[model samples]
Target: MTTMTPCQSLTIRVYYEDTDFSGLVYHASYLRFMERARTEMLRSLGLDQRALLEGAAGAPIFFVVRAMDVDFRRPATMDDLLTVETEVLAVGGASLSLEQRVSREAEPLVSAKVRIVCVEAGRARRFPPEVRAKFERLLPDQA
Candidate 1:
């Protein structure tokens, strides 16, 4: 099993718009929260996704979700303060494996393993060396 790096947490408040008629957060809302957390994680590392996508960082590249395994452990209601925690599980030549968890205080509400790939010119491409190095810094230290 791969050990995950320390998490980058983003706090999100569940809004009415994020909920279904029953007042429970819509299933898809969790995906949006996790996506924001991942974006913030990259931003915290000084990687500007917009710049990368615009080719200002060498070549235009877009990070796209390749796969995801998600588990809904509990339900979240509108106005609930949730934390979306994202951690880098593994970095590869052209892809990244991430673990994200949504929790209300200390209780986990959802969890997912997401795989994302770098694409350029509509084809999968290796991550730029600098970009890969930035993500590598978040990997667990090999002792």
Candidate 2:
């Protein structure tokens, strides 16, 4: 198993709209939270996804979700303050594996394993060298 570095966390306040009839957060809402955390993680690493998509950094590239496995552990209610934490698990030539968890004050609510692939011109492509280098820095020491 790969050990993750310190995670990037984003706090979110649950709104009424994020809940279903039971007042529990809708399952899909967790996806949005995790997505934001991942984006913010990249931003914190000095990677602007929009620039990459617009080809400002290099050839146009987009990160797309290739696969995901999510486990819904606990339920959250409206107005609850939740923290979404994202960490890099693995960085590949053209893909990244991440682990994200949503928690309410240290109690885990949701956990996910996500795989994202870099695509250029609608096909899989290697990550830009700079982007890969930044992600590589997050990996644990091989020793």
Candidate 3:
């Protein structure tokens, strides 16, 4: 297995709109947060989801989540600066394992592991050679 530092990361503030009736971020909100981070991470690798989906960059490609296990350890209140961290934990022929966490002051509020399959036309397919090569280049050096 290999780990890839998010090619990019976008930090965001927890706003009132992100919370529920109790002012605590709703359970499903974390999924949106992770999605944003993951999208940006792919953008950093030069894969623009919008362009791809619009056919400007080619056939629409997506990494559909095949499975995910998330743990909600704590609640994040409004006005908090939450950092969403994403890392590529493993790369496979047609799928990758990603690890993500939402943190405040180095404390984990949530952590999740997601398995995503690379797809085109709704069928799982291997990533392009160039994309896989680029992803390898994003990995930290071996020990």
Candidate 4:
């Protein structure tokens, strides 16, 4: 059976602050949207970044972006409602890869492949079982 991976979507409205003088969203704005979507995805799985990093009764764990490959296919203007879709592409002992896309009414505007690494005390660390389980549940089926 082919399992459907968990995907999360967040809607963001383009504001003047997110755009350039031309009223088009700056390229960096898409990156911010994608980052928010990823954070929300983790929250949906019961992970709180602030608490995790603050060591609130648990070992301090931090998620850091290791690499990003982004493509800007189109520009969004102020007031445009953009949807950021995030999906888990892969998970490793100490890293996770995600695919995120920004779309406007079903039309893709930007796409990115992001790699994140798990760190504790400035060193890479394997994901704890609880955290790994959450990600595993969202793992895409291998073709």
TM-score of 2: 0.92
The candidate that achieves the highest lDDT relative to the unseen native structure? 1
TM-score of 1: 0.94
Judging by TM-score, tell me the better candidate of 1 and 2: 1
Stronger candidate by lDDT (1 vs 3): 1
Q: What is the TM-score of candidate 3?
A: 0.86
TM for every model, in the order presented, reads: 0.94, 0.92, 0.86, 0.91
In model 3, the Cα lDDT at residue 29 comes to: 87
lDDT of model 2, residue 64: 92
Winner on TM-score between 2 and 3 is 2
Which RMSD values do the candidates have, in order?
4.0, 3.9, 3.9, 3.6
Residues 1-143, candidate 3, lDDT per residue (tens digit)? 22345434558798888999999999898899999988877877777666656654355667789999999999999999988988777788888888889989888899999898878888998876766765565554521
Question: Model 1: number of clashes?
Answer: 0
Cα lDDT of model 1 by residue, 22-46, tens digit:
9999999999999999998888878
Estimate the overall C-alpha local distance difference test score of candidate 2. 0.89
User: Tens digit of lDDT per residue, candidate 4, span 17-133?
Assistant: 999988899998898899899888888878888988987426899999999999999999999999998889899999999999999999999999999999999999998888888
- The candidate 1 region of ten consecutive residues with least summed lDDT is 1-10
Candidate 1: stretches off by over 4 Å: 1-5
Alpha-carbon runs more than 4 Å astray in model 4: 1-5, 56-58
lDDT of 1: 0.91
RMSD of 1: 4.0
